[model samples]
Target: MKKWKIILLLAGVAVVALQITNPARTNPPVLHDLAATNPPPAEITALLRAACYDCHSHETKWPWYARIAPSSWLVVSDVNEGREHFNFSEWPTDPELVVKRLDRINEVLDYKEMPPKKYTLLHPEARLTEAQRKFIMDWADAAGKKTEATAPPK
Candidate 1:
């Protein structure tokens, strides 16, 4: 066989092998839905659902591309990491945890870091306008203040 044919054959085999190692993507039962537990206004809920929930919550709506090999690995990894940082499905009841979460949310929003660029590229609905960003910032401010008020003095 030609050298190019050999290379193509190896690439095909590698792709097949990669499929076997694809990570499982699951939407486990939500212990505490954010909306049900601490309902935000409808607009905020909609924005969060569109932009953040795919990775940060138990309700991830896995796309068809997520079922593919290498892409599957990346999508699963991101969701796992996002949940590690903050999971609305498992909202913290403790005031301190709530404040920490709120602070993290504010930091990410202020830095324009959440709803990563790659995500917004494909899912335009996830793109936040300046107005939406301001709204989220306002909500985070209020939530953080409330949590701080309930927290014991350091």
Candidate 2:
């Protein structure tokens, strides 16, 4: 009888929690057209939308289960943290921002840590392939090289 009571209590809490949270009410941010700032080409844009947009851009499409309590908080926090690191919507062409972007790009790409595995679990296509890594690295190399002359020595 005690075990049954505990189960009933837990069930009641779950129902109340879902009704109160209602994560599905949340809406994602909007992605602005950045053509004036030399936005990435279609291929790279597609890749970024798959692998990076969910956390690092103005656009963040949440999944159905992602709307659930603890999971929603985790997803929201990750996106928040990612935006703080670098928001593509507001990337600067200036050397300072460029340098930071270059550095972070390498760090995240090299470590395969940008789009956390937790994200790719539901979004398998978001998983970076070898080709995608090479493309990103190539771009980062070009940016890093461009900023090298004025960049502080290592």
Candidate 3:
């Protein structure tokens, strides 16, 4: 019993020490938010904001767990990776690029590969119903076609 108590105390100290190395969580200024530049319909916009913004945009609403250690690392890493792949807050202005991004969004939605399970497990509000997913996918397809029409000929 005394040995177990010592082990627990050491584990607690290690966790506390790990907090000192927590990565910085930042919400940089929104230089070109997707909605501001090329607005989606109100419902689509709301869906995106709720289901996609935290990780995919610069408008992250850092949760309480994001301030802790190991979980913070995972949260910060996911946000960084998500933004790196496709940032709604730093949307591309080029028509072709915009079309490409929209297509990618549609593909992910079609595959049911977004608002990843890990994220939705924690942020239940980010979970999309089949109808919501279809709505966003349809919007993405329409947006891609619209942008493609405006893209310059290769």
Candidate 4:
């Protein structure tokens, strides 16, 4: 029984290690028309670059810890999902896409989701303070308004 249990535990560990080692997101992220419209303000961009850009942008700045297993899998999964939802790296050039991005950003902020719990756990810096959250929320709102693409033309 003891041997059997040991073997099972080892097998599980192996599987977990394998899953972690196999990165889930590897594509080089891109930024589109970001400079033309919705160019991140220097301060906000710095904040985001330090905090949210890793998983949420095409320009993911990999840390040494990323190479480690377990964490690597989690990180890869997050980057993959983040990109799927809203990739700051791939800012949209089209007005419609820009509107969509703003909507999505608003959704993430209002829901108090995004920069998922797992991400914040490993990446303490990414944790949003009330002030920072408010700043980002305001940024989203203003950008959305500037885009002036809200509401369908009846």
Candidate 5:
């Protein structure tokens, strides 16, 4: 029992020490928000904001856990990776890129691969229902087609 107490104390100290290594959490200014640019319907906008924006936009709402050590590391890393892949706050201007982005969104939704399980496990509110998923997928398909039609010949 005494040995176990010592091990637990050491583990606690290590966890506290690890706090010094926590990544910086930042929400950069939104220069070109997707809504301002492409302008999805209000409902779709709301769905995206609720289900996808935390990690995929500069408007991340850092939760309480994000301030801790190991969890902070995972949260920050996920947000960074998500923004790198699809930053709604930094919407692309080129029509081709816009179309590509929309298509990618649709593909991910079709595969039920987004609002990743790990994220939804913690943020239950981010979970999308079947109807919500269909709505976003349909919007993405239409938006992609529209953007493709307007894109300049390459």
Candidate 6:
């Protein structure tokens, strides 16, 4: 029993020390915000804000669990990956890039692969209704069409 207690105490100390290595999960100043550049319909904006912004934009609302050690590392890593794939904060003004992003958004939504299950489990608001998913997909398709129309031919 005494040996077990010592082992547990050392494990606890190691966990505490691990917190110091937590990655920085910050919301830096947004330069070219998507909403500011080309605003979407209000409902679409709201849906995106509730369901996608946490990981996809600079407006991430870090929850308390995100500040802890192991979870913090996972949260930060996910956020970084999310931003790398699609960041509405630094949304491209280039029409080709916009079309590409719109297509990717539609693809992800159609596959029901966004707002990863782990994320929605903790953040119910991030879960999209079927209607919301349709609206987002329709919007993406329409936006992609518009971008393509305006795109200069190579």
Query: For each candidate, what TM-score against the reference?
Result: 0.87, 0.75, 0.92, 0.73, 0.91, 0.90
Clashing pairs in 5: none
Compose the digit string of candidate 4's lDDT tens values, residues 1-154: 6999999999888966675456644757364635556886887777677677887777887776566676676667777887787777678766677877878877787788876786688778888887887787788778878777554554
Per TM-score, the best of the predicted structures is 3
Q: Candidate 5 overall Cα lDDT vs. reference?
A: 0.92
All models: lDDT? 0.88, 0.72, 0.91, 0.74, 0.92, 0.88
User: After best superposition, candidate 1 residue 15: deviation in angstroms?
Assistant: 2.4
Q: Cα RMSD for candidate 6?
A: 1.9
Error of 4 at 51 (Å): 2.6
- What is candidate 2's local distance difference test score? 0.72
Question: Candidate 3 versus the native: TM-score?
Answer: 0.92
The candidate, 2 or 6, that scores higher on TM-score is: 6
Query: lDDT, candidate 5, residue 124?
Result: 88
RMSDs, each prediction? 2.4, 4.4, 1.7, 4.6, 1.8, 1.9
Best by lDDT: 5
List residue ranges in candidate 3 displaced over 4 A.
151-154
Q: What order do candidates take by TM-score, descending?
A: 3, 5, 6, 1, 2, 4
Clashes of each: 0, 0, 0, 3, 0, 0
Query: Candidate 1 — worst ten consecutive residues by lDDT sum?
Result: 31-40
Model 2 per-residue lDDT tens digits across residues 1-154: 6999999999989876775664443334544333334356678778877888777777777776567766776777777778777777656656666767777887888888867887788889998888898797777767667676666655
- Model 6 clash pairs? none
Per residue, candidate 6 scores C-alpha lDDT tens digits across 25-93 of 889778787776457899999988888888988899998878889989999999988988889999888
Give the per-residue lDDT of model 5 (tens digit) for 1-154: 6999999999999999999989999999998998775899999999999899999999999998899998999999999999998999999989888888988888888899998998899888899999999999899888888888887788
Looking at candidate 3, what is the lDDT of residue 93?
A: 86
Clashing pairs in 4: 29-58, 30-89, 31-89
What's the lDDT for residue 122 in model 2? 82
Runs of candidate 1 exceeding 4 Å displacement: 1-10, 150-154
